[model samples]
Target: MKILLMLRDEFYQANPGLIEDAKKLGDVRILYTDQGIAKDELIKEVKDVDVILVAVVKIDQEVIDAAPKLKYILKHGAGYDNIDVEYAASKGIPVTNAPGVNAQSAADHAFGLMLAAARNIPQKDKEIKSGHWELSMGTEVYKKTLGIIGFGAIAKAVAKRATGFDMETLVYTNHRDLAEAEKLNVTFVDKEEIFKSSDYLVIATSLTAENRYLVNQETLSLMKPTAYIVNVSRGQLINEMDLMGALEEKWIKGAALDVFEVEPPINHLPGMREVVATPHIGGATFESIKRIGDLSIANIVKLMNGEELEHVVNGVHSRVTQR
Candidate 1:
């Protein structure tokens, strides 16, 4: 089997073991490119490859159509939105992701954002840097209500951390995991209630068509004026324009975001004081990268050996039979 690794240069450097393990399994090829490997280039790259591992690169129908020998696709992280899942399914190419690999790291980052926003950490730091002292009063987390938008692994981790701070946790998910919620002592509440009552609202859901603009203007209007919001999930989950409006009108006190609708150009949005933005570094920690790399390699090796994968996003047996 021939395996192609499509990742950034930094990731390649940090996870050298992935390349070595792939080499042991088959003829391994690594392409460190941020130009995103155009459809034609992807076709040429995967012409003779049996598997392709992708990060943020787009893997649409054109690329899938070009690779006849492609057996499986491994996404570096949990989100598979970059891949054409339906097309990959039709082509009988099973796709898998390293789910729960970076759950702790992402949850930690989400909490970091929450703390920063709640306590006005960034604003105070900025004031001190400018030679101002004892300028701002920040809110406390204890006795505050934390509303978690999604009840996934990351959300569970966040809830666990929040409980230690003596904050009440509320969760809202379409397909509620009652057992897990109860186990975490997370109060399962309606979305509107969460929006209205939360002192700190954290978004930890995956991006789907149904939730592209889950936190829109209408939803933002429902939030408390003193509340803070944190988003560590997909950027598009919150409408940027709507968020900007909220911040400008002081509908919400502040927001800390790790992801954005248009990354790198996130600064173009107004309301710098009200919004704390990071360049999508929720899962960029060394520990998380290593875990994701190792898990991705394991999934790839399993697929090559015709064994069951650990986290197959598409139906596992269906792909095998179709292929």
Candidate 2:
């Protein structure tokens, strides 16, 4: 087996142990890219690779079609949107992601954003650093309502942490998972209720065709003028222009985002004081990276051994036959 690691050079540089470890499975090759490589280079590098371990790079249909020996595409983290899963499925290549591996890190970052926005932490830090001794009023999390847009593993983890601050949680998901919600002592509500009731609203959902721009102008209109919003999930969940309008109009008091519709967000995204933005680092913690790496490696080992793969996201099943 020949494994192609389609990851950042920094990642390859940092994890020499992982490279040595991959030798246990196959002859591993490292191909670095800043999210994506040129089509020609990608085609050249991917040819005859048995497995591709992808890190944030976009593996489109063109690249997928060029790889004749490719049997598997393993995602380093929970999101597989960067891969062309439908096309891969058509070609009988199984695609899998390391789900729940970074849930704790992601949840922690979401709460960090919530507190940062609510307390004006970033601005105050700047003021104090500039030799100005000033006090800024920050909102107290105690007894406040926290609305979670999705009640998945990460959202559940956030709700669990919110308990330390004595928050009341309301959740809005496609379908209510009543048992889990009850376990967390959270209430399930409609989308509008989530907007109306939360003192701090955290967008924790995945990006899907149906939910793209889920928090648009109309949804923003429903939020409290004093409320704060935090997004730790995919950036396209909130419409950027509508968020800009909402901030300009004070539809919501403030926002802290770990992801953006466009990375290294240009234009008004970087210029707004009402917004606190991160370069999509919600799952970038050291612990999360290690966990993701371990899970991804385990999947690769399973694939090479002709065993059932775990965390298969695109409905591809076990290749191992039971006769």
Candidate 3:
């Protein structure tokens, strides 16, 4: 079996033992990319691979079509939105992702962003470094309303942390899972109600065709002027232009984003003082990366040994078997 790793060097740096572990299942090869070049280079490398472990990289139909020997495509992180899972499934290739492997790390980062944005932590730190000793007026989250967009593993993790802060948790999901909501001690509400009531509106939902730009100008209009927004999920979940307009118009107080519609956030927008943006480090922690790597490699080993596959995002797991 031939395994291809198309991920960052940092992933290997964090989990140095994975290389040895992967060698037990198959001959492992790596394709490290820093320039985001996938189509041409990835096509050249994946020709004879049995499995490909990818992270934040686009494996489109073009790349999938190029891999003749590919049996499995394992995402290094929870989100498989970057990969063309459906296309791979059509080609009888199983796609798996390590979901809940980094849920706690992402959840912690979501709340961290909320606190940072609310208190202007970044701005104040910058000012303090510039010889100013003033403090920014930060809002309190204790006993406040916390609204979550999705009720996934990471969202549930956030709900648990919110409980620690004595927050009133409200959730808005496409499907109302009353039992699950009750277990989390959360109230199920509509989107309108979530925006209207939350002191801090956090977007933990997955990126889907239906919910893209779910938080737009119209929805922003419904939010309390003093409320804040935090998104540890996909950037496209909120419209960039609408978010900018809302901040400029004071529709909402501020935003803390781990992901952006366009990474590196091309153009400048108003209200930088109110926005705390990170380079999508929600699942970049050392512990999270190690767990994700372990799960990904385990799935590859299962496929190579004709064992039951875990975390199969596509329905093609049955097609992948031992050589």
Candidate 4:
């Protein structure tokens, strides 16, 4: 069995031991690349692979067709939107992702970004480093209204944290669990109310075709000028151009981003002190990676050994064994 793992250089650096463990399962080929890797290069490398473990590089029908020996395609993290799981299923290739393993890690980072944006933490630190001493007025998070876009694991984890700050959590999601909302002390509200009432708004909903660019000029217009928006979810959810205009016009207080639509963003909007950006490191903690690594490798081993597959996103697991 041949297992091909593709992620950035830093991820490999953090999990040298995990790579070694994967070698114990089969012939492991690791690629150091980001999400925007060329399709030709990916096709060339995947020609004879039995398994493909990818982080960001998309696995469309072309790449799937190129891998004649392909049996399994595993996402190193959540958000299998990068892969065409339905197409892979049609081809009898099983696709799975390590989902919800980094909920706490991502939730922690979301809260951190919220506080950083609200308090202008990065801006103040920069000023102090440049030999300036002055106080900047920051928003008080204590007892503020926190609005979340989804009710998934990460969102739930975030709502749990909000309790400690005595925040009123408002959620907007198509999949409403009233019992869970009552238990967490979060209210299920509409999108307009979420935008209008939140002191901090977090985008945690899973990215789908329907909800892409969920945050636009109309939504931004509804937000209070003092409210801050933090996205710990996929970047495409927010219209970057619209967000840029809002920031320039002070439509909202500020924005903090963990992901960008075209990462690493071409513009970055470095001149805008109101914008704080991170390289999608919400789930990059060492602890979270270990959980993803263990689950990913274990799934791969199961596939190779003809054992029961876990975390199957595509319904081709049974067909894969037949092939």
Using TM-score as the measure, the top candidate is 4
Candidate 4 Cα errors over 4 Å, as ranges: 318-323
Residue-by-residue lDDT tens digits, candidate 1, 72-191: 888988888989988888777888888878899999999888888777788788889999888567888887999999988899999999978988999888869888877788898998
lDDT of 3 by residue, 154-174 (tens): 999999899889999999998
Error of 2 at 67 (Å): 1.2
Q: Among these predicted structures, which one has the highest lDDT?
A: 4
Model 2 backbone overlap count: 0
Better of 1 and 2 by TM-score: 2
Report the lDDT tens digits of candidate 4 across residue range 53-86.
8888889999999999888898988888889999
Model 2 lDDT tens row, 226-256: 8988998888898999988999999999899
Error of 3 at 125 (Å): 1.0
Query: Lowest lDDT 10-mer window, candidate 1?
Result: 314-323
TM-score, model 3 to reference = 0.95
* Winner by TM-score between candidate 3 and candidate 2: 3
Measured against the true structure, the TM-scores of the candidates, in listed sequence, are 0.91, 0.93, 0.95, 0.96
Estimate the overall C-alpha local distance difference test score of candidate 2. 0.85
- Model 2: residues >4 Å from true position, as ranges? 8-10, 13-15, 318-323
For candidate 3, the 10 contiguous residues with the lowest summed lDDT are 262-271
